[model samples]
Target: MRSKVSIQKLTMSYYLKDRVVTALNGIDLEIADGEFLVVVGLSGCGKTTLLNILAGFIKPTGGEILLDGKPIAQAGLMNRGVVFQEYALFPWRTALQNVEFGLEMKGVDRKNRREIALKYLDLVHLTNFTNIYPHHLSGGMKQRVAVARAYAYEPEFMLMDEPFGALDAQTRESLQALTVEVWQKTRKTIFYVTHNIGEAVYLADRIIVLAGQPGRIYKEIRVDLPRPRDSFDPRYVELERETTRAVRQG
Candidate 1:
């Protein structure tokens, strides 16, 4: 697969009081085009930091990022879409309007934006809730809106930070299936961060594990399980166990 994004010796650090906290250290990675990549580890492993840098929300303290062979100095919504665990929907905007928000910002005409938003709402199976507000929707429904909003913008890649973390077990599983369905249809390169080893194994074509305290890549595991993986299958169980052990060791 062709490289969509490349990181070379990536490092990040921040200062607090008289001390410095290193978030990432000498991280090198290559994300393939249309690949589903998941980053997993314990808290403070710089998973979110990596996702933030990839989204161009924060500049690395060292190293550089290349997007499609070009240096990415602060890419905005045009090139990347972010879906946070919090959903980040506008309370004032209806679900349809929330999905249309990015298109509106990009100056997409009303008719086109509405059409695109509706298409993605259908993709996430949320078409019936398009007129509802965030406060009126369930947690999973709100995340679906968030996913639709991200997809409506038509970005080449999606940066997801534990998007299903807040949901109940059943809802999370359902959303995971929805996310895979959307990914299969869109084929967008996805970089997702999560602490759930099972979820990562279930969703990713590849997994990168980060170790904490100036986090760095600890392991890279390629999951070759057949799509629509069975969580109860022995192979899936084995991989999940290995991934969990790697995270624990990290």
Candidate 2:
């Protein structure tokens, strides 16, 4: 069977005036269905750029990205869902309304949309905040709403670009646990991007480290540790160290 997502010899470059800057250099990867994969790299390492190519937001100058043996041409709702570092919740919309926005776009009816959206809201433990606006919610709450919105649509895959980066350390850890719980319950395939090695190790089924000026796979580490992983575990620390060494080496 084909993988859920596949990248073959993926390359991207941006034209900065007359000089072309290479953002990615020959990236190849495959994500199995329901796999939680994390990518770590320093700033300017093309981690986010790589995700954009997979999500069809940025076209690669070289190579093709395939899903189920077919090349993806442009962005669409059927294949992928994306979340940003900053929670892009609509301030005017209440928590429930923000989640229901995606269903509204899909033409899901009012009654059905409310029912489905509520189920996901409850999954993220945000039922009480349903009637509250984005501004009324805390930073972590907004991200929870964002997660609910993304998952409520029930897309085949998720692309997260540092969704937890903006939160405090304690809040980040709490949300990470929440994310794991939701994933275990829902089995959603996620391509999560982060600079934190510990975050990657704690959440990922596999970790891919990107490195160098022209980003490439510096190291790919398979996390054999079983879930639900603890941040305090020695094995978790070891995995983070291995990925860290790969980054330094690259």
Candidate 3:
């Protein structure tokens, strides 16, 4: 796989009152095209911050980011789609309309937007709920809508910040499966940040662990297990244990 995004000496810091806080320090990494890469670490380890920078939600204080070898100089959502843990859907819009929001912003015509939105809603198995608003859906269903909305844009990179973190175990697992389904279908590059080591191991092609207060890559673990992996399977368990150990000991 070719390198889809590159980060060199990435650093970030900000002032809160009289103190300067460092979020990331001297970070260096590369994300492959069509790869599912997950970042894991303890809280305040800058996992979310890194994802935010990648999503162009924040400007790094130092270093540079390159997308397809070109410097990313501004915050924009052209080819990047983000799924937040909060299920950041429009409360006023129906499921189909929320999915169509991005396309609308991109100036896609109403007719084509509806067609594309419905297709993605079906992909997430929410076609039947397309007419309902966010308040009418369950947490898992709302998240499925968010996932569908993210995929509707056909983004080059899908940036997720603990997207399933807020759901229950069963729902989280279901959405995890749904996420893999979407990724398999679209083959989009995914950069996800999560504190759940199990989720990271289960979903990632490669896992990057960040350590220390000013976060930096401590270890990189690759998952070689077959897809539709069983958590109880020997190889899967081994990798998950290894990843968990890395997090605890990092």
- TM per candidate comes to 0.98, 0.97, 0.97
- Model 1 agreement with the true structure over 1-250: per-residue lDDT tens digits: 6589999999999879999999999999999999999999999889999998888888899998888888887555488999999988999999999999999988999999999999999999987999999999999999999999999999988999999999999999999999899999999999999999989999999999999988999999999998888999898998999899899898
Error of 1 at 67 (Å): 0.7
State which candidate, 1 or 2, has the greater TM-score.
Answer: 1
Candidate ordering by lDDT (highest first)? 1, 3, 2
lDDT of 2 by residue, 29-98 (tens): 9989899999999989999999888788878999877776678774364577788889999999999999
Number of the top candidate by TM-score? 1
Error of 2 at 134 (Å): 0.5
Compute the lDDT for candidate 1. 0.93
TM-score of 3: 0.97
Pairs of colliding residues, candidate 3: none
Reference-based TM-score, model 1: 0.98
lDDT of 3 by residue, 117-231 (tens): 9999999999799999999999999999998888888888899999999999999999998898889999999999999988988899999999968888999999998887788
